[model samples]
Target chain A: EAGVAQSPRYKIIEKRQSVAFWCNPISGHATLYWYQQILGQGPKLLIQFQNNGVVDDSQLPKDRFSAERLKGVDSTLKIQPAKLEDSAVYLCASSSRQSSSGNTIYFGEGSWLTVV
Target chain B: QKEVEQDPGPLSVPEGAIVSLNCTYSNSAFQYFMWYRQYSRKGPELLMYTYSSGNKEDGRFTAQVDKSSKYISLFIRDSQPSDSATYLCAMRVQGGSEKLVFGKGMKLTVNP
Candidate 1:
């Protein structure tokens, strides 16, 4: 089975510019997530999608960030007027099941964004 | 106080040495614990997962969880250069959306 897939592997943008990243989770996986990992920090949850609906996005910066999982298969995370602090690795992950535990979360290589 | 605390180490060790990594959490509701290893510029992969408290070993890796103290540990036996990467500890409550709360990853380098 194929793992989660993401692109583009790296991105460079200037402050106030807009950027977007795409993710394709493993087939049959119902849970998809987007996380932001600043340098020297662990990945922080930005948003989560269960099927085609939103599950949790309380931590998402709604003023600048937005994400959508269309058709419950692929996802896209976008950031407008990107801040310098938004320069981080954008990770996409998916899980086969939606229990509190047991299922493994598989991640992509991540999209590295550098905002100047 | 943070929900989870991990010593962010650029710890260097020689190959064949025993490596121990750990994390502590403040949330008592977190009943599921997991460890993930990430290579530079890459995303993390699950190394192990433990429910409640106890020890779970997979090959050369061992994970220990202590709910009473809210502490968790990961041990790599006979470390290898391939083991060089960042190790992250994550946990979540049993219900609701069950999103994971992660700690600052600890960087480990196993020398040849």
Candidate 2:
């Protein structure tokens, strides 16, 4: 089975510029998530979607970051006026809500962003 | 204090040696525990997962959870160069939310 798919494996933008990342989760998975991993740190969740609805986004930077999972199969995360601190890897992951082990999430290769 | 705490180690060891990684969590509500391995410039991949408190083993990897102490550990046996990567421990509250709280991953290198 194919795993989660993400695009624009690498990206670089100047400070104050905008950037976006896309993700296509595994087939039939009902939950999708976006996380940010700064260099030398563990992944920090930015948002989570269960189908077309958001499950959680408390940690997201509301002023600069936003995400959407329209139609529930794919997702996009965007950051506007990107800052140097926003440089990190954007990871997309999915899990089957129907499975008993729903906590086992699978991640994509991630989109790397470097804001200069 | 952070919900989860893990030592960020860039530990290096000879091949075939045994390796141990650990994390401590402050939330007693966390019921699901997991370990993820990430290579350079790549996203994290699930390595092991356990529910509640107990021990689970897969191949050369073993995961142990001690709820009373709020500690979790991962042991790799006969470690190989391929095992070199950053390991992260994560956990979440059962029946609450699916959001996972992660630690500051520990980096390991197995030199041949």
Candidate 3:
């Protein structure tokens, strides 16, 4: 079985430019998530999707950030007018609704973003 | 105070030495505790998971949860240079939401 897949493993953009990252979760996983991990810090949840609908996005910067998971399978996270602080790794993860360990999530290699 | 607190250690230890990492959480609702290892420029991968308070061991890794003190620990036995990485502790509420609350993560380096 294949793990989660993400596109554009590394990205570099200007502070005001826009950037997008794509993710394709595991075939049967129903829960999808996007997280931002800055150097020296743990990942912070950006958005979460259950199937095609969003379950949580409380920490997402609504003004400059937008995400979508269409058809309950693939996801895309976008950052417009990116800030220098936006430079970090965008991690995509997925998990079965319930497992022996109560939803063990698997993460992709992540998209590393650098904003100048 | 942060919901989860951890010592962001850049701890260096020799190979074959025992390594211990810990975290304390303020939320009592978290029922599932986990540890994840992340290499530089890579995403985190799960190392251990435990529900409630107890110890769960997998090979060289051991995870312990103490709900009474709202504390958790991860122990690596006979550490190897390959074990060098950032370790993060995460927890979530049982039953409904799957969102994970993460700590700042601690960096460990084992000399060969």
Candidate 4:
């Protein structure tokens, strides 16, 4: 089976510009997640989606960031007026809801964003 | 204090050696613990996961969690050069929203 798929493996934008990343989760996985990983730091959850609805986005910077999973399959995360600090790797992951036990989650290769 | 503490060591070890990694957490409510391996320019992949406090083994990897002490560990036996990567520890608090609290990862290199 194929793993998660993400577009634009790498991106570079100006600090004030807007950027968006796309993710297509595994076929049938009901849980989708977006994470930001800075250099020298672990991946931090930016948002999570259960099907087409959001399950959690407490850490998301609502002021400049927004995300959505439409039709319960594909997801998009956007950052407007991006900041230099927003430069990091954006990772997407998926897991089946059957895993109430919190089993393994598969991740995509990630989109590396660099803001100058 | 950060919820999780980990020593970010760029530790180098000879091949075939035993590799041990650990993380300490501050949240007593965290019940599920996991370890992930990330290669350069790649996303993290789950290596092992443990619930409650005990050890779970798969092939050369072993994961251990101690709920009483809020400590977790991952051990790799007969390590190979392919095992060189960053290891991350993550935990989620029980009875609340399932969000993972992660520690700064430890980078390991297995010399050939």
Name the best candidate (by DockQ).
Answer: 3
Candidate 4 lDDT (Cα, whole model)?
A: 0.92
Candidate 1 residue-wise lDDT at B35? 98
lDDT of 4 by residue, A1-116 (tens): 89999988999999999999999999899889999999999999999898898889989999999999989999999999899999999999998857755745789999999999
Interface RMSD (Å), each candidate?
A: 1.3, 1.1, 0.8, 1.5
Q: What TM-score against the true chain A does chain A of each candidate get? A: 0.95, 0.97, 0.98, 0.96
lDDT assessment of candidate 3: 0.94
Report the lDDT tens digits of candidate 1 across residue range B55-80: 99999999999999999999999999
- After superposition, the stretches of candidate 1 with alpha carbons farther than 4 Å from their true spots are A98-101
Where is model 3 more than 4 Å wrong at Cα? none
Candidate 4 lDDT over residue span B53-74, tens digit each: 9999999999999888888999
Clashes of 1: 0
Model 1: share of real contacts kept: 0.77
- Judged by lDDT relative to the true structure, which candidate is superior, 1 or 2? 2
DockQ per candidate = 0.78, 0.78, 0.81, 0.74
**Pairs clashing within candidate 4:** none
lDDT of 4 at A3: 95
